[model samples]
Target: MKNIYILSIGKVYRKSNNLYFIDKDKNKRVIPIEGINAIYIMNKVSLTSNAIQMILNKGVPVHFFKEDSKIGTFYYLGSLLPKQKKPSGKVHIEQVKAYINVEKRSEIALEIVDAIRYNMIKVIEKYREVYDYTKTLRNLDVRKEFEQKMTDWKDATNVIRGIESNIWVIFYEALDKILKTYKLERRTRRPPKNEANTILSFSNALLYATVLNEIYKTHLDPTVGFLHEPYEKGRFSLVLDLAEPFKPIISCRILIWLINQGIVKPEYFKKDLMGVMLNENGKRVVIKEFESRIRETIKIKGKGRKSMLIFIRKQAYNLEKALVEDTKFKAFRLVY
Candidate 1:
């Protein structure tokens, strides 16, 4: 039910009637402006200040990305940090304790790491024959087996960082898969060669953006993070927090599906002066794949009536409620 108007082409303007108007050929059409949560301006779509103001009044932010897919800026008129309420000392101590609790709560965080790592490993294996990087990592797995290890990870922090290390290896391996899966005599950037990689990255970006958006409304400070550092340009700590729960379950699943279905291959990306880049065609292929992924849903474990999207929104709200009510905060733990 969340509506996102993706403006990849053309321009839009706001009318006096409080409607957004767009031009097609020589005729003007009214774009459905209601129910829109955000507008993504891809390829730097132009718009008037009046249009921007109208959108801000409606509580919809505008996301601008450069032509090369770099994050340009986010235009949300309100201050995300304005008049912030501080958590009481008791509440703050409780949050840290909840995070460190040696119970089901601690296991909840560990589960997220394991799920994400497992899915990343699957992606590498799925495309093992295609990419050299996959082959290298796969070979390393064989060699590392001699080290011998028990599967159980007792410490939650150790479990989380350990899984992340393995996931990074798989991420590079997946990138390699895209490079070798396709066959072309000369690499060209006219269109992206690896549709799978393009789509996966796009999907991750969207996921991260959503996390950051939700964090702004919560009592949890977005800047303070554990795994991802709070940096100057991209202080995306909150996104990292949210992605911890979803990496293996959603991102990894989409990667594996693309490889198995032959939806994307090495031919989808090309090497250029910039190293590797997706062509326009590849971008379209991946965007479509990402759309399909967003639509894919998992049944929420509890509250049988609600879907995953509903579950995610509720989880964000719950964090805020917990903080305001001076209760412990629990992060979402993905079971599958």
Candidate 2:
């Protein structure tokens, strides 16, 4: 698993042989080259030719952000994130073709919802004994009302909540027995103060945002998603579409794992005057764990293939293609 290294700690400068890390004030620090998947230069992080050569040889992509935080330069291994400045008009036409299959899109959207719901059922099944969820899903005339409900899924909270509650029930009996020490509970959208949910949401957004940004680099456009609604303000709903079933299993497991392993203790974070924020040491713990979890393998069903961290972006790209081509969209199911 590779890492998207955040040069947030300090100025990143290139040294001989490998990339060297330096602080803002002026202190040389050595960086471990083994774990980096990509490097993000959020600001004016510097690198030398020798250092660039080493990073390039390792096939690490380097990204530079402008003052406004818009992505400015993309450094592919030895090159940049890629500038398809002259995309073939024919390819562009094909991309459009993939994006505009109306009839196929409707079927794909339904299948994608089914797949997401199916995986969601697994999340529920983990907690409760299977009673008659088949009937519940069968009654879901969401298909007929998708056009409207997609706009206001806040109404569907009752349904999503029902499913979430069913999932928690199964764990309820076992959780208290196993997690007696950490005092665990099934958390919903908002996590309690002094808990790790803030870090999880922040990390998840960072992860999903990066993947969505990268998916755009491919021939696939970010619009025309199946599960999520397309609204204003550059809403990359497609990424969220893919991220739906993932949040509980991936991030939830990460939170539990970090707690059980003592990587992050309750003391690592504090509810400040503003809100819950991880202290310096706590940020390091979560940042590292989030990157590691991103790289962790989650067996994806239907594809019959094993996926790593980067495969997430690839899957999102595949979903975009599936949606555009009117093929059935297979949601990424996380096998626990």
Alpha-carbon lDDT, every model: 0.51, 0.52
- What residue runs in model 2 are displaced by over 4 Å at the alpha carbon? 15-18, 24-37, 41-82, 85-108, 121-194, 259-263, 298-305, 320-326
- Which RMSD does model 2 reach against the true structure? 7.3
TM-score of 2: 0.63
Model 2 lDDT tens row, 220-312: 555545445445345565566566556644555566567667666777766644445555566567667776777666666445455445556
- Score every model by TM-score: 0.63, 0.63
Lowest-lDDT window of 10 residues in candidate 2?
68-77
* RMSD of every prediction: 7.5, 7.3
Query: Model 1, 240: alpha-carbon shift in Å?
Result: 1.4
For model 2, what is the alpha-carbon lDDT of residue 166?
Answer: 47
Question: Distance (Å) between predicted and true CA of 231, model 1?
Answer: 5.1
lDDT for 150 in candidate 1 is: 23
